[model samples]
Target: MRKGDTILFETPPAIAEFAAVGGKRESEGPLAARFDLLFEENTLGQETWEQSESQLQRHCLDLALQKANLAAAQLDLILAGDLENQCTASAYTLREVDVPFAGLYGACSTMAEALGLAACLAAAGFVGHAAAMTSSHFCAAERQFRTPLVYGGKRAPTAQWTATAAGCCILAGKGQGPFVKSVTFGRVRDYEIKDINNMGAAMAPAAAETILRHCADTKRTPGDFDAVFTGDLGIVGTRLLKEILEKEGLKLDNHQDCGLLLYDIDTQDVQAGGSGAGCSASVLCAHVLPALRAGKLKKVLFLSTGALMSQITFLQGESIPGVAHLVELASEKEGQA
Candidate 1:
């Protein structure tokens, strides 16, 4: 094996299920209650995304490393990124953990990008072991990028819910673990969907294009893989994905292969879907891990999709740009390791 070659995703407690455990009754306010449902435990009642992101990464990384039985120094490389512009959240939080690292930002698709780079390095014998981590916070992201929740403003139907959480994965050189067979990168598309009210509309094209590329580059059909998932395109983005993919002669099954809409909290009432980098990371950490561990899922594709356009960019008359990253996660084949 090479430096950053083999990748393994550590299974962790599901965010929704974990949030639901010893579940508390729904609280007041749709947005507030929505956050409470997803991150109440990790949040400790923080009202802002900045606060939540800071706290969650610190705790989540510890749990992830523990589950993997990995020490900070054991990893030769730590590649991290997130939805936050400067990525200081992961920077500051990761400081508590001792490791050499680099900060990255691909919006929602950050984890995939980091993994993709890690895999290339490993495959090329650049490094032996690497860890990729990314996270998001609803309060911090919304206030800085969108409208502050304190104003009690009404969000449009297209608005996606920002999730508060974190996710981390360890990639080994070539030692008995899930192998990252390949990674497919997508082109950026600016769709002019600047409403900020409809991020799903903005990010759907990116997801569709990337998924199409993955199938094309790998010479595999949608049916070839057990699942083809997207980051946080939400309900509307998923709808757009179905339509767009069909145009390109590709189709995705939401029930089986997609990861667009995972937040089902009753209070959020977000008609479109979930948003933010954490939306995908949290769901992958929760649902995908357990399914793989149970031996119920064999091969799965994870596409972390993101809308690159920021609130200020939209206000500045720039269109909402999008990008999607594809990662293949599969357990070892019979006796291959």
Candidate 2:
């Protein structure tokens, strides 16, 4: 397998800076203080949800550049993605910016996928500096994935609330802060669960497979990390992942889910918890990165999970497929020190 699915970067690219922006609903969450910008209106001063999502991307880009103290022209490339079909939000975002951009789609796993690619590019010396970012909007996702807002249909307990937010990070050739040590790209796993409403169940197998592969390839264990975070598994998915890992004779000491951490599940009425691409992206940018930078977290794993399903496939009675990607981040070489 040649080091397997995990890619160890020789140069070890580091995140120079990052930024996270959220919408009104997300701003009301427990991690509200971490956000760089929160919009009072979901429109983001725009007329539609799609436009608003694009603005969210733009907001993250501007804030990221400001935090890094770098200009737009200085970025070698920008990698971005979103939940909209055809990557509409990311496409519009790139159109307005002059930097070279690559659009990505991994459902909710976009953030980890994009960051892994960006880190690899920088680590390989192909790019000196690159921007990796992603975003999601509740209104836009629901309208496309399920029913229209006007329908006002009841949601199941397993349903997750898509976060309306954006997260962007700048990867440099060399710097401090949370640095990428390795990235494990996941393979598609379909467990044959066809309920479109149950996203956590759809994505759990993929998450488990990737984590197991990464640990086996790197010779690391759950206790080796300060925290292991999954993208948007919510309450249900978290429990499922734990069970799957245990059956494989692996156990996690400090495991967390971006979906569960984003909001108060009991009080927020967020069914299982938060989902969507931006949920993990925004949470990591606002909370996780800060912890890494502050030395509170010595080593962490950001595993983004995605459900590879579409309206057409769902209508055709096809089961949902899933994928996950993992990025290992360390706090500025603390273990070696």
Candidate 3:
């Protein structure tokens, strides 16, 4: 994270490739429609983590730049990453695009970090435009970081299915148009939980810690913002986060704090909570952006939480490393000084 970064951009614009809830092609399997939404196909045979995740991010970014009507050369940086270890997917996808880049590692918090970086750069007058992008593939990430395809290990009720998707947003300086207003980074916390199956429990404390810090740093009350959203903590983690926050003397109202679990899917069973880089990306791209445009929400605080652990660490009896990053999104136009 940078030392000094403030909001100077007007407002940021985002885009995604998935029908979170309903679409004309709901009958198609999730994989097929996901590809169709991104204007790609499974030409590489079975879905490889590298191919699909990279494709979705690349296409989504192209669309984002197009929407913003800016050429690739205009961007000073392309901050991108994903949940995969070492961020292989986001790195590979960024290679194909044209921009100076910084690879980030925060699992689900990748996108938030990227946005924060861009906002900081723009505010510091380091660049006029920068883009933040991230993508996740259920198959690729699971096969590599957690379990193999053949394992098929039984998932506990606390498991959250990784969502397969990608999201991109264009953050421009005052010259580039409306963009991010402000970004806050969370301190990484060490939680001794090592079991991967119970990720929600492991990550909850981190969320709680960050939520309190964000409220304090911004000097804002819970009721001041329309909603406070967490990236993926699902059911179990969300409850734990709220509980921990209140215990710390910070009260988060029910409607005020919303968790991006299961996206817009209810019938779909998400065990502990939704977990993935795509979980927060998809929800923000689909619901939050539209809600902001519709004037349904005024200020939104998006806090993306991640469990910073690897299968190797867990196997070696290492404790899980968890982190969360916060980005403040507001629908109202900037107030002139």
List the candidates' TM-scores in order. Answer: 0.83, 0.98, 0.84
Q: Compared with the true structure, what per-residue lDDT tens digits does model 3 show for residues 41-60?
A: 43223356567667667666
By lDDT rank, best first, the candidates go 2, 3, 1
Better of 1 and 2 by lDDT: 2
Candidate 3, superposed: residue stretches over 4 Å from native: 1-47, 175-179, 254-261, 264-266, 335-337
lDDT of 3 at 128: 69
Per-model root-mean-square deviation over C-alphas: 5.8, 1.5, 4.4
Compose the digit string of candidate 1's lDDT tens values, residues 83-134: 7768888887777778888888888888678767776666666666677777
Give one clash count per candidate, in the order shown: 10, 0, 5
Reference-based lDDT, each prediction: 0.64, 0.92, 0.65
TM-score of 1: 0.83
Question: Residue 289 CA error for candidate 3 (Å)?
Answer: 2.1
Better of 1 and 3 by TM-score: 3
User: Residue 109 of model 1: what lDDT?
Assistant: 82
State candidate 2's TM-score: 0.98
For 1-337, candidate 2 gives per-residue lDDT tens digits of 1268889866568899999999988878999988999988899889999999999999999999999999999999999999999999999988978999899999999999999999889988888889999999999999999999999999999999999999999998799868888899999999998998999999999999999999998888878899999999997889999999999999976999999988889789789999999999999999999999998998889999999999899999999999999999988744421
What is the C-alpha local distance difference test score of candidate 3? 0.65
